[model samples]
Target: MGELARALTRHGIRVRVVAAHSPGLPVYGKIGDIEIVRPRYWWPERLEMLRREVGGLPVVWRKYPLARVQILSFFLMHAFVTARYAQSCDVVHAQWTLSAGAACLGRWVHRCPVLVTVYGSDILQVPRHPIGAWLTWLVLSCCDRITAVSHALQKRVVQLGVSPERVLVVPIGVDVTKFLPADDVHRENLILFVGSLIERKGVRYLLEAMPQILSVFPEYRLVIAGDGPEIISLKQRAVELGISRQVDFVGFQSQDNVRVLMQRARVVVLPSLEEGMGAVLVEAMACGTPVVASRVDGIQDVVTEEVGVLVSPANPMELAEGIRTVLFDPIRWREYSYNARLRAVKYYNWDIIVPRFIQIYQSLVG
Candidate 1:
């Protein structure tokens, strides 16, 4: 979203980001030309823990049952602020399905078109619950257009009875210039994993596979970045596997730090059980780093045989083999490194993607 706002502003479009309030960030501020408004959803401000984690509200709700009270307030304030801004904007673009439900309310005030972009969970996981399905349907029914991050997500939206014409696949863009290969261009004996340490991310499987991966490449180390609910258990599992020394849990990383890591790492791995589209994979590829990810959902769309290796989702042995295949083979690794950069620039670069979004906005506005 920060990238999108910056890109939009560069193209002479004014952008205002209205988001859920966080603890330290100011309620109103400016990042360059972009306006940011974070509406407060809960009272006694310290109790505002709804938007803290990677999983957002669902994770908070499950961990602290009392936080459920803030859900209603979040929706109300979100809708009110959205409508407040909607009165001035040319169009309203919401990033998630639940947020779109609130953004849609702005249509009642401004009568402007609303477009919601589904990342992954909103269409895939949310609809599994009975009430969630009804709410999702209501949200979809209210939007003028829908944009999915991947074709897999688009198919899921279509399954929910949204018209194919109403939905388009527009992935989040990456700044390729900033995420470049190291100037020295020396790849290290490091395997990198970046994302929330969640069960669905399949990080445990990566931990399980590390023992086998280390036996062959003892010099190599697995660097797990990003923290989540599974961090503690994942650390314990690493100890049990006796590959604790071979793995380093770096917790969350800033984008600049991740870029530097990606540039140096021999391979960036994302062993996700499910994904809308692996944004991290694209970023790694941009850094001329080959990937070893699961052969599931939109990951397949990003990783190709020319760029990297793909293995079965939950199988540790296959993942180990996949990692070894890229690690040991000098010719394949070099080819993957070269092709990875080309593929990322051609498909996922912000230069290529942001224009597509501008087109979408023009089509709707016209």
Candidate 2:
């Protein structure tokens, strides 16, 4: 969002980010040239973003009645807040499909166009819930326009009975300048995985493959970054597999630290069973790091023979082989590194991606 806001600002499109964060008085701020208005939602605001980020105390909201009430209350609150702020805006660009549901209500209040962007799991995983499918379909049906972060997600939107013409594929871009390779530092034999520690992320398969990886490249170490419900289970799995000493569960690091890790690793792996676009792959690529990922969803969109290798999801032997193949051949390693950087700069940079968004906005407004 920071990248998108800055890019829109750069294109002379004034952007005011409306964010929902933890409890506090509504705060207004600037990130670069863009203005931001963060209006706290509902009372207490302690449970703000609980559905999105798994950061709250497990409460009764997970139950149907309480959860539905919260959702309805939030829709009313969000719509009211958004309508007033978006009064002068040409279009309201909501981040997630669920947010799009709120934005759709806000649009009815304000009489403005709404463009909803799907960032992977929102479209891919949300529909699996009993009520989520109908809500997703309703939101997609209500939007003036829909932009998915990848072709895979766009296809999913179409599957939800949306016309092929209504959904556009606008891939998420990374800050190439910040994620660039550090030539002065020596890269290590670190197999880095940066994402939420969840089942869908396929971190288990990567952990499963670690013993084989360590068998061939004994010096190699696995670094699992990010946090989630499965952290303890994953740790226990590592210990059971006897690779506890070889794996590092660094919880969740700051973005700068992640960049540093990306620069230091020999190969970055995201063995996701499902993904939106796997933005981490592009970030690693931007840092001139080769990737070994599953041939699923948007990971397949970005990774190719030139930049990285893709294997079947949940297959440890195949993943281990792909990683080993990338690691063993220095000639291919050099090629992969060079191509990774090139691919990131060519396609995944914000400067290139933001214009595509502006185009969508223009078409919608017209």
lDDT of each: 0.88, 0.84
Q: Where is model 2 poorest over a 10-residue stretch in terms of lDDT?
A: 55-64
- Per-candidate clashes come to 1, 0
Residue-by-residue lDDT tens digits, candidate 1, 1-366: 788888888778889888889777688999888999998887678778886687656678788876787888888899989998788887888989867989887678967788888988778788998888888988998898899888899898888888899999998778888888775347789999999988889999998998888889899999998988999999999999998888999989999889989998999999999998999999999998999999988787899999999999999999999999999988888889899999999999887888888888888899
How many backbone collisions does model 2 have? 0
Candidate that would win on lDDT: 1
Candidate 1 wrong stretches, greater than 4 Å: 183-185
Q: What is the TM-score of each candidate against the true structure?
A: 0.97, 0.92
lDDT string, candidate 2, 172-222, tens digits: 898888899868357997999998887788999999999998998999999
**Residue 306 local lDDT, model 2:** 96
Cα displacement (Å) at residue 227, model 2: 0.8
